[model samples]
Target: MNFLRRVFEHGRFGFVLLLFVLMVSTLGWKIVDLHVFDHDFLQGQGDARSVRHIPIPAHRGVITDRNGEPLAVSTPVTAIWGNGRELQAVRDQWPVLAEALGQKPGRLSERLEQAANREFIYLARGLTPEHGQQVLDLNIPGVNALEEFRRFYPAGEVAAHVVGFTDIDDKGREGMELAFDQWLAGVPGERQVLKDRRGRVIKDVQVLSNAKPGGELELSIDLRLQYLAHRELRNSLLEFGAKAGSLVMIDVRTGEILAMVNQPVYNPNNRRVLQPGVTRNRAMIDVFEPGSTVKPFTIAAALATGKWRPESVVDTTPGWMRIGRYTIRDVSRGGQLDLTGILMKSSNIGISKIALDIGAEPLYSMMHSAGFGQSTGLGFPGERVGVLPNHRVWKEAEIAALGYGYGLSVTAVQLAHAFATLGNDGKSVPLSLIRRDRAQEGHQVMEAEIAHQVLRMLRAVVEEPGGGGSRAKVPGYHVGGKSGTAKKVSTSGGYTDDAYRSFFAGLAPLNNPRIAAVVVIDEPSKGGYYGGLVAAPVFGRVMAGALRLMNIAPDNLPVETKTAAVVPGKGGRS
Candidate 1:
C-alpha cells in the first residue's frame, strides 16, 4: 500500500517508466536463455535437418577419328567428396579414415583437419566406379561418392598428337580437347539428397541432366596413310639415327593434309613421358630456313617478272660469286646452267642473279602472294606465323642467299603448301586438314600454265641423274622436287656449321600432279646430311606409299629400270 501511495505521489510518468523497465528485464532474461547456452546445439540440429549438395557429374563427350575410330571415350567412375563440417565433427578418427581410403595419415589428417569447419571438400577425384563402391561399402562418416565420367583414349599414341587428353576432373587441357572444350564437356544435371547424422545420403531426388552430344569432326587424314607414314617415318628415325624429323603429305589439287607425321611421337593416352621438345607439333610450330625447297618460289617469281624462262641460261662462273661480303656458290659451282639446269643443280649463283634483277620487292611480293609469311589458319595450337623479312631489310648478301632459300624461315606445312601452289599452277590456296568434298575447295591460287611449267622444272630435278633431288624419284611415277641444306642459326648469332635442316619439296605424276609434299629433318646426325641424301629418300618412300594408298595411277610405262622410266624425257624432264 505504501509503494502504491508513493507512486501516486510521484505522478503517472514515473510509474509508467518503472513498468517499462520491468517488461524489458523479463524479455532480456528469455533472450539469454535461448542464445549462449543452446547456440551450438541448435546449429547442429538445424544442419542435421538441412539439405546437402548432391553432386551430379556431367557426361563427357566422345572424341573420334575421321573414320569413327574412338580416340577418347568417357568411362563411368566415382569421385569422393566430404562434408568438411561433418568430418571435423568426428575429427578424432582422421587416421582410421585415412587408412581406409588408402591415404597416409599425415595427408588425411591435414585434409580433414583443415576442412573441419568447411561446408564442402573433395577427398579424391575420378576414382574408378569399382573403387568408389569399395570406399562407399566401408560406410565411413562424412565421406560421399558420386558416379562421374572418366576419359579414356584407346588409339593411344596414334592419336596422341591430335586429340589431347583431359584432367582427372574431366576438363579439357590440350590439343583438340582444349580447343573444343565447350562442345566436348556436356551439361551437368543436379539432384537433392537428404543425409543422416552418419553423413550417408538417405534419399535422392532424381534430376535428369541429359547430355548434349558433341558434333563429330571429320579430319582429312586417312588412317591407312597415317599408319603408313607413322611406320615409315618411325623406321627412318631409327635407321638413320637422326635427332628428329617431320613430314607433311598434302593433296596437290586440293591442299588437304593426308598425313602429318613426326618423330618422337607420344601416345595421347599415356602422356606421362611427353617433354616440351617431343610434344611440339614441329610441322606447324617450328620454323627453319627452307634450304633449296624455296627454289621453286624464286623460279616462279622470276618467271612471273618475265626475266627468265625454262630455257634461259646463266653462266654460273666458278659456281661462286662475291655479293657484298657474302660468297654465294652452288654445291657444284662454276657451270653454264640454264633455268632448268639451275633448278636441277640447285645453282645458288644462277638463282641469285635472277633475284638481283627481279629485286627484293617482286620476290617478296611473290612469296607473300604465295602465302609464305602468313598463318595457314590451321586451328593449330601454338602455331607460329613463319618469319619472312621485309623487302627493306634485305641486305646485299641476304638477297643472294634469300634467292636460294636462305635468309628466311618457314614451317614444314608452309613449304608443302607453297609447292602445292606451284603444282596448282602458280595459285597457292589455303590448306586444310579437315575433310572436304571436291566442290568445297573454293578457289585456285596458281595458273595452270605456271603450275605446269613449275612441275616441268621440278621433274628435271628428279629425272636428271645429277639433278639436286635425284634421290626423290620413284619408279613409274614422274616425280619432281628440290633439295635444300640450311645451316642452323645459333642463338648467339652467326650460323652453326654442323647443324643443318635438310629439306625436300616435290609432287608426283608431273603430267598431272595430285599430291605435293615436304620432308624436313632437324639436326639429322646421319653421316650424309644433304637433303638429297637424307630427306629425299624419305620423301620418295612417303610419296610411293602415299601414291599407292591414294590410288594414283602411274604415268610412266613399266620398265626394267623403274628409275629410268621416271627420269626426264626426250625433252629431258618436261
Candidate 2:
C-alpha cells in the first residue's frame, strides 16, 4: 500500500511539472514571434492600417505687367473635403454640414452615398479663408480643410483678355495663362504620413519630394496703356452702340505689344459672368477686311517697283472703274489726283489703276513682306493667320479689290504690325508678348526712302484739310494714318450692305515715330459707319493718352505764326 501511494504521488508531481513547462514554452514562443521573428510584418500591417501618402500642391506663378505690376496672382485659400465612409456615420449631422457647405442636405447625403466606397470627395473648392474657418469651427467629423490657392486678377476686366484665367484647380484655361501653362505650373510633392482610424493625420513621417513654386512671368503689356486703351474702346463702344471693338498699340522700335484691349470684356475674377464670344482675345483672333488700311501697302508696292513717285498723278475723274463683271466705285469723285491726293481722297479707282499697273506679284510680295498671311509668333493660343490670296492664281478683279483692302482679311494686330513696319522705316521685327532685354534686329521689307514717302503721304491724310482721316490728328502731336470702311461679308456668301468693319491704323510724331496703333469697330449702329468717323477718334484718344504716359514730347508746337488765346476766367497771360 505504501509503494502504490508513493508512485501515485510521483505521477501527480510529474504531470503538474509538465503542464507548467508547456505553459512557459508557449508563452516564450509567442513573445519571440511578436518581438523578433515577425516584428517587421506586424509593424507593416499596423502602418498599412494607419499610414498614407499625401500630395503637396505647388503654387502657380504670378503674371505681371511690363512695369512689374501684378496682373494675375495666387492668393491663399482653403478647400473642404470629406471622407465619405466616415461621413456616412455622421448622417444625422448632415443638415448642419450641408448648410455650412452651401449645399442642400439631400444633395450632401446623395454625394456621400455615391462616394461611400471612395476615401475622399470635395465638399467645397476655393473657398475664402473666413468661410473655410466657419466650417472648421463646427468641428464636424470626417470633414477637413486643405490649404490651396485661388488666382486673383488685380486689373480685373481692364486686363482680363491679356492675363486670362485659371480653373478651380489652378490650371490655365485662356490667354497668356494658357499659352505658357507648363512654364507657369509647378510640380507637386508628396509625404508619408500617419493617420488615425478616423483619417486625421497624426504625424508626418517623411517627405518624398520638395514642392517647387512656379517661376514669375513678366509680360510686355503696360498697365497704364492697357487701362487707357480699355477705357477708350469701352467708351467708343457705348457711344457708337457697336457690336464690338478691338485696339492694339505696339512699340515701333521693339515690336512689343504695349496695349491690347477688346470690348465686351468679362472680369476674370468672376467666371459666372463669362461668355464664349466675350472671352476671346479679339485683337489677335478676329479677322476682318482691312478696308483702306491696305492702301499704303499698295502705294508701297508701286513705289518699290520704281514706277511711281509721291507726286505721280492719276486720272480718277468719274471716281469709278469697271473690272470684268464687278464695278469698283469711290464714295465721291476724286478728280485728277497725285499719289498723296489719292490716299487723302481714298479713291478706289485711283488705287485700282496703280495696283493693276504693278501687276499681282509685286503687290502680293509687298503685302507678304509686310507680315500679311502669317502668324505674329506671339505664342498666343488660337491666333489666326489672316488671309492673303496667293498671287499666282489672282484674277484681275481680285487684284483690284486687294488694292483697296477688300479681297484680303487681317486681324487688328496684323494691321498694327504692318503699320509698325512702316513706322520702323520698312524694317519688320518679330513681335513679342514678353519683355525684351534689348531691341531686336529687323528684316528690311522695303527701302527706307519708299517707306518715308508713304509715311509723309499718310501725314497729309491726317494734317491736310479735306483729307479722309483729318479727325485722327492729336492736338499737340503730328499724326499719320489711313481710314478704312469695309462691307462685312455675309454669313451665306457675298458682302452685306449695311454691316461694315471700320478701321484706323496709324503712327504718331511723323518726325520720328515711336508708337503704332490700330482701332477696329465692328458694325457700328448708332453713329456713322465710316472709319474716319468711328475708328479714328478712338485712335486719337488712346494715342494721346499713351504718348503722354510714355513721356513722348509733342512734335507739333503752335506754328510760330499762330497765337494762343487767353482765358478770361483765370489770372493767366495769353
Best candidate (score: lDDT): 2
Lowest lDDT 10-mer window, candidate 2?
565-574
lDDT for model 2, please.
0.91
TM-score of 2: 0.91
Residue 516 CA displacement from its true place in model 2, Å: 0.4
C-alpha TM-scores of all predictions: 0.85, 0.91
**Candidate 2 displacement at residue 32 in angstroms:** 3.5
- Per-residue lDDT for 101-164 in model 1, tens only? 6789898788777777786788877777777777777666778887888888886666566666
| Residue 566 displacement (Å), model 1 | 33
The C-alpha RMSD of each candidate to the native structure, in angstroms, is 7.2, 6.2
**TM-score of candidate 1 versus the correct structure, residues matched by position:** 0.85
Question: Which runs of model 2 end up more than 4 angstroms from their true locations?
Answer: 1-34, 559-574
